[model samples]
Target: EAGVAQSPRYKIIEKRQSVAFWCNPISGHATLYWYQQILGQGPKLLIQFQNNGVVDDSQLPKDRFSAERLKGVDSTLKIQPAKLEDSAVYLCASSSTGQWNNSPLHFGNGTRLTVT
Candidate 1:
């Protein structure tokens, strides 16, 4: 399967600035997920969506971050008033089904954000 499409592979911004990243999941994928991977640590699931509805967003920083999947095909993640600690690789992954553990995740190259 082809990889999920993600844009703006790298970004540099000052602290408290806002930035956004876009993603297009693979065709026929019913589940989409966003993750934040800090250096030297495993990727942390930020949000999960089954089609256009959100399945889970417990780990997402709602005060500074937001994401949406419109019509179930594409999605976007945005961070407003970003903090220095928010610097990390933002990953977009898709799976054949909503059952995350049951389906293999096809991940994009990811957008690396740098907060100065």
Candidate 2:
């Protein structure tokens, strides 16, 4: 099976600018997640989607970030007016339905955004 895919392995942006990242999860997976991982820290869940519907987005900084999975397949995340603190690795993962904890999520290499 094909693995998860992400674009622009690295990005550099100035503060107050906008940026977007894309993700394509593994085929047949039903749950997808986006995480923000700062240097030397565990990945923090930013948003989750069960198919095309949102499952959790409590950790997302709504004031500056937004995402969507319009067809329950590919998804995108965008950051508007980026801040210096927004620099991090944006990771995307996927797992089978009803097996979140049991199924190990597959991750992409991620888009490393550097907010200047």
Candidate 3:
């Protein structure tokens, strides 16, 4: 019954440097999600994956942001040449299939990225 795991907790980077964050979701969960939470705002879904295939990525910024859930397990989110607005908490969550509407997502505290 392991919960979601994230790394670095915090990061500070220049506006043009690239940064990456990692996440390991709960065991036996079939759906994984990545969210960006800016200060004072609710989490916004960046991408979602059902197993190895992407279920939704409509909100992801394609120009300089990318993500993947390799092997249908651990996932990574990368921001290349970061921007000042990219500073936010990157949260990961997972839920068992068929319980999407009933079960709440288990979220990692998140990796707080700061662009200076």
| lDDT tens digits, residue span 10-84, model 2 | 999999999999999999888999999999999999999999988899999999999999999999999998999
What stretches of model 3 exceed 4 Å from their correct place?
Answer: 98-102
Ranking by lDDT: 1, 2, 3
Candidate 2, residue 103: lDDT: 86
TM-score winner between 2 and 3, please give it. 2
Candidate 1: tens digits of C-alpha lDDT, residues 1-116: 66799999999999999999999999999999999999999999999999999999999999999999989999999999999999999999999876646988899999999999
Top lDDT: which candidate number?
1
Stretches > 4 Å off in candidate 1: none
**On a 0 to 100 scale, what is the lDDT of residue 49 in model 2?**
93
Query: What's each prediction's TM-score?
Result: 0.96, 0.96, 0.94
Model 1 clash pairs are none
lDDT per residue as tens, model 3, 26-48: 99888889999999999999999
Give each prediction's root-mean-square deviation over alpha carbons: 1.1, 1.1, 1.4
> Native-vs-model 1 lDDT?
0.95
